[model samples]
Target: MSAGTGQRAAAPGPSTQKPRGIDRVLAFVERAGNALPNPVVLFTVLFGVVAVVSTALALADVSVTVPGTDDTKQITGLLTGAGVRWLVENLVTNFAAFPPIAAVLLMIMAVGVAERAGLLETAMRATLARAPRAFLPYLVALVACQAHMMSDVAAIVLPPLAAVVFKSAGRHPAAGLIGGFACVTAGYAAGFTIGSLDALYTGITQQAVAVLSDTHHADVNILANYFFTAASSLVLGLIGGFLISRVLEPRLPAYTATADAPDASESEDIRLTPAERRGLLCTGLVVAVYAAVVLSLWLPNGAPLRGEGGALVPSPLLTGIVPVLFGGFLLAGVTYGFTVKTLSGSEGVVAAMTDSVKNMSGYVVMMFVAAQVIAVFNWSNLGVLLAVKAAALLKSVGLTGFGALVAFILLVSCLNLVILSGSALWSLIGPVFVPAFMLLGMSPALSQAAFRIGDSATAVITPMNPYVFLLLALLQRYEPEARLGTLISRLAIFVVPFLVAWLGILAVFYGFDLPLGPGAGISLK
Candidate 1:
C-alpha cells in the first residue's frame, strides 16, 4: 500500500512562480507548521518546570488546603526525593508496563504489515469505492474512528488518504481532511475493537477502583465499554459525515465542485498484487481460526468472555480484555506485506517493525512529558483534591441513578480539560466515586464505563489533550489556515451529539441491567 499523503509539494521547481489561492493556502500551512513551537519541546519544558516546583514545595511542607475538606495532607512530592524511591520506581514501572503498550505495538505491527502489503489502502479504496458521494464524509469519519485500533495510523495517515479519497471521488480535499480528523478526534472514545488508550485506561482503572472497593477483585475489565461503544461508533460516524457534507464542506475555502477528483490525478496509485490478495485471504483465515480458538476458550461453559454464571455480555474475556489489536494488526500487516512482496523475508519483517518503532519517536518524547506531568500531579495531591470536591458536589445535587451518572459524566468531561489523562483522572476519581456510586446501587464497572465515555468524548475538544494539539498540527497539511478555536468549535458541535448518543447507550444498558463486562453489570448485585 502507498503512504496515504502527498509528499512535500512535489519539489517546488516550475511552480516557484508563486502560488495563488489554494496553493498559497497550502504553502502557508506548511510554513506555519514548521514555525510553531514543537509541542514535544514545549510540553517537556512546561512539565519539567511543574514537576520541579511541585517537588520542592512538597518537601518544604508548603501544602495547599484541600478544597471542600477539613483535613490537610502532605504532598508525596516527586518520586525522586530522599525517601521516595518507591514513587520513582512506580513511575518507571508504570511507563515500562506492558499489556497496553505491547498491545498497541502488536496491533500496529499487523496493521503496518497490512498497510505495507496494500491491504488497508486497497480496502479503503474498495470499501467506499461504490459509496455514494454524499456518504463520503460519514464513511471517512467512521473509518478513521475505527482506525484508532490501528495505533496512530489514522492521525498520521488517514487524513491524507481521506483527501485523496475525496479527490478521487470528485470532492474537495479540504472536506476530506475535516471529515477524517472529525472521526479521529470525535470517535476517540468509541472504539469497538481494542486500542492503546483503552488498554491503558482499563488497566489503571482496575487499580483505581480497587482503591475503595474490593482490593483483591479485578472487577473492571479492559473492554468493559465495548458493545455499547461499537453501536455509538456507527451513530457518531454517520452524524459527523452529515454535518461535514451539509455544513462544513460547503463553507470550506478550497471547495471543489465535484464529488471526486479525476482518477488520473490520484497520488498513491496503489494496487493489490495477486500475492497480496492471497495474503489478505490467508490473514482472514487466520483471524477466523483465532476467533474460533478464542470462542472455544471463551464461549464454552464458563468461558472467559462470559460472566461467572456463563452470561455472554459480562464475560471475563470481555472485561479484562487485552485488546489483541496489537497482535491482530501485526499479524495482518505482516501477512499483507509478505503476500504483496513488500516484505521479502525475516529481514523485511524486522525492518518494518523497526520503522514502526521509529515512527513512534515523537510519541515516546511526548509520553515522557506526559508521564512527568501526571507523576507530579499525583505527588501534589491536586488530582485527588479535585476529584473529592467534584464528587461531593455531585452527591449534594440529590440526583440518583442514571441522572446522577449523566451528571457525573458531564463533570468528568469538564474536568478532562484540566486533567487530560484518563487513567490519571480515573485513578483519582474511581476510588472516590466507584464505590460511592456502588453504595448508591450502581455497579463499579458501569461507573468505570461512564468515566471512559466522558473521558474520550471530550478529548477532541480539549486543548489540554496532547493528542488534540498534535492532530491539529497534522491537520495543517490540508488547511493551513485552520485555527485551534476553529477546530475545537467545529468539534464541539459533534461532541453534543456524541455525548448524547453515548449517554443514551448507557441508559439503555443500565435500564436493561445489561452486563458491562465479564462478571460486571450496570447495577450492583
Candidate 2:
C-alpha cells in the first residue's frame, strides 16, 4: 500500500505521445499473432498436420542418411498399421512420459506452497525494501529476471509485488508492474540460479537430442545454459532498469488523488509483521538444516547423489535437481506456514499443495496435445530427416558456424510472436536444431543458448501471450483508458534493447568459445 498519504494520489494515464514506427510494427505483429488458435488447439492441429505430412512423406518414400552413420532412416506413415498402433499405444504414455510434466508439477507444487504460506512474498518484499531507492528498478528487474525458478507463480506474483515496491519508493507503480511483467516473460532465460524452467526447457531438449541420434548423444541437463544465463541476468537487468526508470517513468503523466480512483496503496504496507518475521526466521532454519543434509549426502565420492566416480554433471544430484528443489521448498514452506499459522495442520499443508497443482490445470491440457505431436514427429522420422537436410544445406552455404547461430536466433524470435509457449516452440523445433547444429560440430547447448535469446527478445513484446492481457489489466488501474495497444507500445521499447544486449552477450560467449555451463561448450568438440 501507499507509504504515505502523499502517495495516495490517483495514478496517471499512459503517455499520449504519437505512435512511433516500432509501435506500428508491434501493432501489426499483435494483430497477426491474435489470429492464431490457443496452444492446445494449435498443438492438436499440428498433431493432425504432422500425421498427414508423415503419411505423404512415407508414400513418397522419403528417407535421409543419418549423419556420421551409414544408417538410412525412412519416414513412416502415421496412418499405417504400425503407425496407428504406435499412436494408440503411446497416446497416454506420451503424456505420462512427457519430460517436463513431472518436473513442472513438482516445481509448481513446491513454489505454490511457499507462495501460499507467504514466505516468498515476505522474503522478496524485504529484499526490495532494503535496496537503495536509486537501485529499485534494477533490483526489481534483476529479481524478475530470476523469478522463473518459481515457474508460473512468477507471472501472478511479481507484478503486484513490484507495484508495492515501486509505490514505497515514490515511483509510478505501473512502471514496476509493467517492467516486472516484461522482464519475467521476456528475459525468462536470464537467471542466476537453476529452477523449474531449466528443467522444462532442457527436458524437451534432451528428448529432442535422444530422438536425433540412434547412437549415444550428449544429454542436456538443467544446467546446460547456466553460465551464460547468469551473465544475461545482470546485463539485461541493467538495460531493463535503465529503460523503465529513465525513459518510461519520465514519460508517465502526473498523479492526483481522485475519489473515483482506487487507492494507490489500498492501505497495505510491505513490511513483514512480527508473525511473518518469526515465520521467515523459522524458514531460514529449515533451509539451513536442509542444506546441511544435502551437503552430507553430496560430499563423499560414494554418496548416492554423486555420479559414477563422483562426477557432478552426470550425477543423480544434477539430474534429479527438480525434486531437490521440491524438497527444499516443501521444507521451507511447511515450516513457515505452520510457524505463522497460515497452515494449521497436516491437512493445511496438503491443501496448499493441492491448490498449487490446480494452477497447472491449463498447462496439463496443453502438454497432452504437445506430447502426442512430438511423439508422432519423432516416430515418423521427420525431425531426423529435417535435421539432415537442414544441416547439409547449412554446410553447403559455408554458414555452419556463428552465421548459422545468428540466423537460428532470428528465426526463433520471429516464430515467438505467434508461438506463445517456449516449451511448446522448443519441443517442435529443438529436434531439428539440436541435430542440425550437432552435424555442424556445434553442441546442443549452443543451440539451446540461441533459443534463449530468440524466445525472450521477442517474447517481451508479443501480444500472443495471455499474460500480456493480464499486464494490460494491471496497467488499467493506473491508466483507466489503457488498452492492449498502450501496453504493446511500452513493451516495444524494450524489445531492441533486450535483443541487442542478448546478442552482444551471445557473441562474446561464442567468440571466446566459452562453456555455456558445466560440460556444455559452444562446440561439440
- Lowest summed lDDT across 10 adjacent residues in model 2 is found at 1-10
lDDT of 2 by residue, 251-321 (tens): 77774544534476652567778998899888998899998898778777787787887876578876777
lDDT of 1 by residue, 289-399 (tens): 776777787777866566767777656666435554555666666666666677778888777777766776665655555454544455465444444455556668877
Let me know the TM-score candidate 2 reaches against the reference structure. Answer: 0.90
- Per-candidate TM-scores read 0.69, 0.90
lDDT of each: 0.62, 0.81
Error (Å) of candidate 2 at residue 41 is 2.4
What value does the lDDT take at residue 370 in candidate 2? 83
List of clashing residue pairs for candidate 2: 1-265, 2-265
What lDDT would candidate 1 get against the real structure? 0.62
Q: What is the Cα-based lDDT of residue 259 in candidate 2?
A: 56
| Top TM-score hit | 2
